[model samples]
Target chain A: MSRQPRASGYFRTSYQADRALVATRLERAMLVLFVVLLLAFPLFASAFLLDLACQVFLASIGALSLMLLTGYAGQISLGHAGLLAAGAYSVGILFREVNAPFWITLPVAALVGALLGLMFGLPSLRLRGLYLAVSTLALHFVVVHAGAEYETRRGYSTGVIIDPPQIAGLAISDPRAWYVILLAAAAGTLLLCLNLLRSRTGRAFGAINTHETVAAALGIDVARGKLLAFVVSSSLTSLAGALFAYYRGFVSVEAFSLFLTIQYAAMIIIGGLGSLLGALLGAFFVTIFPYLIEWALAALPGAQRRASEFFAVNYAAFGAVMILFLVFEPAGLVGIWRRVQSYFLLWPFRHRPLTGARK
Target chain B: MADLELRRLCLRFGGLSVLEDVSFAVNAGELFALIGPNGAGKTSVLNCVSGLYHGEGAILFRDVEIGGYRPHAVARLGIARTFQHGELFAQMSVLDNLLTGRHARIRTNALAEMFGLPGVRREEARHREAVERIIEFVELERYRHAPVAGLAFGTQKIVGFARALALEPTLIMLDEPSAGLNRDEREDLARFILRIKHELGITMIWIEHDMQMVSDLADRIHVLDYGRTLAEGPAAAVLRDERVIAAYLGRAHARPAAGAAGGGAPGGR
Candidate 1:
């Protein structure tokens, strides 16, 4: 029998192109442009903008972790902020008490975070949906409380101080240098996550999310996959925390809280679950939303003095936006962008339909 | 020869007895059919054999005890099964759904997958080829890139069959393969079942409700009533048996009449 020729357009029929990170040449060019813009941001922006960008990078890492666990694996975790706190606190304590170098303490922090994730993930064997969400919520409160109490106990400390270490005779204490380092790390992590999603483990994760019983029937170890997802997600979040601690030169319990968990959840929701580009989009929206709101409010009369209340207003806006997006665009912003792209791609052929849309 | 033997398999759910002293042996290259009335625990039997449920008995896969093993372990031992409800991954494409069936045969490490190693690439290529062949076998080549959730019920069933076939399984278990199918779909499924046994020489254990299809396609039939094997022999002999006629067929045939008018005797046979 003669085999049919493989289709080779924007979409390739071969397995390699089907599983590629960037499917088309246009996507690759777009990615390169994004990188160049990111690299040039620190040079052109002010110190405040640089700091905001750093926060965005940190939040993006956390959002990426959530995307892997919730979006890809179909597992919900409300306690991820707890895992992040665990990592941040472990790094803080190690550097403060043991005098461990920043680079040396980073891996230890990830390990500790992974251990905590394992402990939390154990419940996943018997729990799912709202039950699992509640369990994780409990975990979040417990970790945040423990961190707050620990901080209070340490004498002469409003927050633990962190000293950045020198790497090969180059000091990393400067904010601009740290920003570059954080940017590199976040970008690498994102690439790693993207690569992972195209792999067997990622496929298994997707399979389990779609149908755990079917995945099990296919010889995918569902339990192991769930646990692995939790571990990887926690490790990434912890790495972000460790970097954030060193960059900020302090470790405060206030930084890691349930509100932060909600924010991360919001990021995944707004970006588009299970899409890497969605996570970055979500991070940008969440990080800049408050600033944008503040700026708009400052433009109004008698609003400059109410700047402190912007946090509450920002939260209200976040809630409103989340509800609006959930109602109108359940697939999030990425879904909308995909629809628009497909609409353009199929232009001039009115009846030709895109494949992914379910009838 | 790949054969499966269920040695006095018993399953109890909490206070309810679902399967009791159920024992059977399916030979290699045989189209063995299990016919039962509603709630006769036919699906439970499939679940027990496929390791979805732990039961008190020995399930021998070519003489190796596979009872109480995890589902993935059972699957790795060359046993594959489909669900009664056609459990296709709704969000994944048809090709992905078929690829999942070849998961047991494609052995690649997480590191290999991460870096797109040569081994992973080769295995992925092999899996894709096998999946494509199965898709062609099921006459679903057109829907290869289609999302399965939006397909017609009959097409979804074909996707399920293609997925099970992608494993190159030694013994494939089909759970109610013709549950919601029309006459044409049922005919297509019957032909596929016969093809699996005749052309590929793959052993099959199927649970089907359509008596006509069972009589035509099954080499042998096992009739179950209230968690026990009521009869076992050739399809003609079992279907014509007195006890099976009294318990299952009589009750099934009388359901429409009873629902038409006033209440009748609860145990109407």
Candidate 2:
């Protein structure tokens, strides 16, 4: 979460100290407070707020998956929502066909996602950057078409209706239960991503992204790293989609559109590419933004007249904000957050000399 | 026994030939030097051996054919290489970048590693200890945690050498390891190379246009001029050869850039 690689007075004498995620007492306290707040949230929050929290949790998982692949591995993908759809549709198809339980549906979703990841990753072996992005984009269309065809063939004209997933003979559709489950899922994913990044697997991703020739020369299997990244990221994303399907009790091809894919991409870019905190922050911002816009518009005098084109206004606003972030704050919110923290941390001392700059 | 052998190698781009029938053999525990003028395809020879380039020839290590293998597969057979332009992961810390050199040796399964399981964690500690020793050897402790991208060019080159050393390579190919280093750093590098050869018994292929470093450290010199072997023998014999003096030494003194390739230029890349 700290942007500075080395913070003031953070001397690490051992490897354990160097790798510790929470070093200072302040960080530990902050983490405790954060967890306490999260647990207590559902106790006092409104139903709508609880649902929003669930949505943010779901989006966090997908955003984290995208961050792992694109931010860390440096593999650009535009088929994220397609993978999500695959997961959701797998649950739908499996449940409708064999009366599959939630347990069966979730793993099936992950498996389908892994296979699709393999298919998508094959093209990355021969392409990079924009070309690879385009390849993923094309695959997204194919996946959406498959899901649409399934819906039409199954005679579900509107969309598939997913039953509330049950665990231990109890339904999980209660807002409180859903909130806790989603929170646990999001927390587990964050932990998983943190560990992977600190391991050799994550370093290989960074190496491949920085320089493919160098990565290969250093004995990293470039193709394997790329494919493994896709597999792991897609698996996590599909799992998130399965959770989404269960949360909403619905699965619709129309829901998983190109705009949805763009929104997920926006999450990573707006969050901060390499930082997990950025993904969570970006998810929070994107998920709550439309509501905020609607509220603000309602407060305006011409709200009734503007209601006709609210969707259009939302689309234009999102695009404009994305562009502004890209041009003015390339590092996203994390970068800006760090700069502000540094300013306060180093008050009365404006500039650090080159020798002192590292810490 | 020969540690590595490149036999009748040929590489080209379209109609332009980059390496023409280039053949060389490095012996066990020997520091072999490859010297040539710019665009003489010296780096190409290393590239072909490291599996970065596809050439028409056979490359053998320990009597096993490795010509067409991928770079990682070849590296798994205990060969390591450094780049001329410092092809390092710039955003990563020096320690992280060096640990990457040991990627081939890490055999933990993905599942085990994902959870930071006991086996991989212990393995990581061992590798980290080795990397720390390298950081000490190169005197880069101050920059160990700093990103390689922000380090000075000379320090980055030192990090590059330390990274290759981290591989514990049996056969190390150093492509201009001391390119941008200062006098003190170059001297330290020379000492490191000497210790690596005499103490560790690692075979090395040292490429450089700096004749002094090459002649001082190399057991043998293989000279190239315009993608052709100009001379090959003991350092003293090759240094004295008329053709070597005329083709390489004479031009290097006239124009230094003529000896160092303009990295990633429109040449054989």
Candidate 3:
């Protein structure tokens, strides 16, 4: 593999260097600093802000899985919320029925997700593009309806209440503890996704995503690759869902709606398709955006008068922002980040040479 | 035994027959050229052999029936192919593109890959070394890290060829390797194909449009006309066959001495 010489004078002398997740000492230091900041944030943050950070981490897990399926694998799904619901319901049912512990429920939720992923991925073998999306959408309704049926049958019309998960006699109810747990989960998910993307399986997904025919010709099992993407993504989504259940202390069909699915879709699309960092950034943006909008509305002159219409205004504003992103920045927030990075990276020069003849 | 053999291969799309009762055998370490006019089903033959199409016939590789196996299965049996349009993973880097060809060779499981286990990293390093050999062979070292989408068409074509070589396949199928290449690139391709046949001792089934290049490189020529075989024999004789000229070649073009010498190198096998 080849690379343009960096201004930092970092050169890889071995294949391992080329394959490293963090190639340079500066990057390694920056990653460590970033991790330190994330870990220390809970010590100083207020309860509200800490909760918001937890929400971002939860959304990030969901967004990253969605990005893996729809972004990298090119398998469209409108059933993300349904998959999330499946996870939540799995946790709720297992805990209520069998009094399953934290460790047991999470894996069960993931297994349930994998099974449902295979079922959802079946139609993908025979359909593509809009048709595949429609099938997933239909499956989403089925899943949500199943959850609703459980709620009604169990006579818990409101929702299934979940106790906070515990590990080694310590309850994860504290905001700071939840923060650490979710942070670790999110980081683990990120690492897992990164590992998958760098290997042979990931390459097969990318190949099939680009062109199934060519991928098949190149000896990639396109059908198996598609199924694998679904299974992995669904299991991850389900895990996030189970985490959401424990974190919120409830599971309700109302929580997993068509709009929730769209929000997840928007995260990947507005984050930039096929990028893990974009997924995280998109998650952060979408999670914090409501608060930003609310703060803006509160600062307005007629805020008290328009309080009842807040939800409607927020929905409309979200749509408008998504449209703006799709139109002006189709590459998502990651595109903006790259431009800023390049600006600093190429300081004193406005543009790269046409032929990439860096001297 | 022939490295690859097709017996009475037939392919149909609805009512239209794309290939009709075509059969050919490529011997071990021999470069067998499949040529014809447009829509002569030259590419189709490669497709059927590579398992992209399920043709009604017997396709044996090293005496093993491989007709109905999936593409990946056939590739696991040590067959590799390049498409007419390169068909490289457009968004992936050239290194990744080549690495995908190593898919069938990858021994690590999904769990290992997801965990980035030490074994996976070591396996990846080993495969990268193999892929690097291919890049060196094709002289694509400069473009190794660049994304395939940004490369010139000629370079992408070569990358496609290099990817097939990375498979370390016993039989490599090249579909129109010289189709869109400029003269220099074509020469480079011809040289590479020759080296593959002579140095690596790999058998090849090459679908070509350039008669000069085909005559120069192919040890045996198989000509098709409207989905049927018109001539199948030694390159010089087949090129001179009257029916072959009438159906495809149309006229007698002088065979250059350089090509004849290059073509002669494979006969020793």
User: CA lDDT of each candidate?
Assistant: 0.82, 0.86, 0.88
> What DockQ results for candidate 2?
0.52
Interface RMSD of each: 5.1, 2.8, 3.8
- Range of the 10 consecutive residues with the lowest summed lDDT in candidate 1 chain B: B260-269
Q: How close is candidate 2 to the true structure, as a TM-score?
A: 0.95
Per-residue lDDT of A113-197 in model 2, one digit per residue for the tens?
9998989988999999999999999768988899899989999878889899878888777899999999999999998888888
Q: Second chain of candidate 2: TM-score?
A: 0.91
Predictions in order: chain A TM-score: 0.92, 0.95, 0.96
Q: DockQ values for all predictions?
A: 0.42, 0.52, 0.47
Q: Per-residue alpha-carbon lDDT of model 3 for A1-359, expressed as tens digits? A: 22333554666788877888878778789999999999999999999999999999999999999999999999999989999999999999999899999899999999999999999999999999999999999768988999999989999899999999888888778999999999999999999998998998888888889899878877788889999999999999999999999999999999999999999999998999988988999999999998999889989999999988888889999999999999999999988877777667778897853323211
lDDT digits (tens) for residues B1-269 of candidate 1: 54999989999999899999999999999999998878899999988877889999888999999998999988888888899999888777788788877777878766566566777777877788788788888899888878777789998998998888988899999998987888799888888887788889999999987777778889999998899999999988988888987876565566777434313222233
Candidate 2 CAPRI grade: medium
Better of 1 and 2 by DockQ: 2
User: For all candidates, what are the clash counts?
Assistant: 0, 0, 0
TM-score of each: 0.91, 0.95, 0.95
Rank order by DockQ, top first?
2, 3, 1
Comparing only chain B with the true structure, the TM-scores of all models are 0.92, 0.91, 0.92
Candidate 2 chain A: 10-residue stretch with minimal lDDT: A350-359
Q: Highest DockQ: give the candidate number.
A: 2
Model 2 clashing residue pairs (backbone): none
* lDDT string, candidate 3, B1-269, tens digits: 79999999999999999999998888999999998878899988888888889989899998999998998888888899998888888777789989998888888877799999999999999999999999999999988877777789999999999989888999999888887788899899989998998899999998887777878778999999889999999889998888887776543243354336434221111
* Native contacts matched by each model: 0.54, 0.61, 0.68
Local error of candidate 3 at residue B99 (angstroms): 0.4
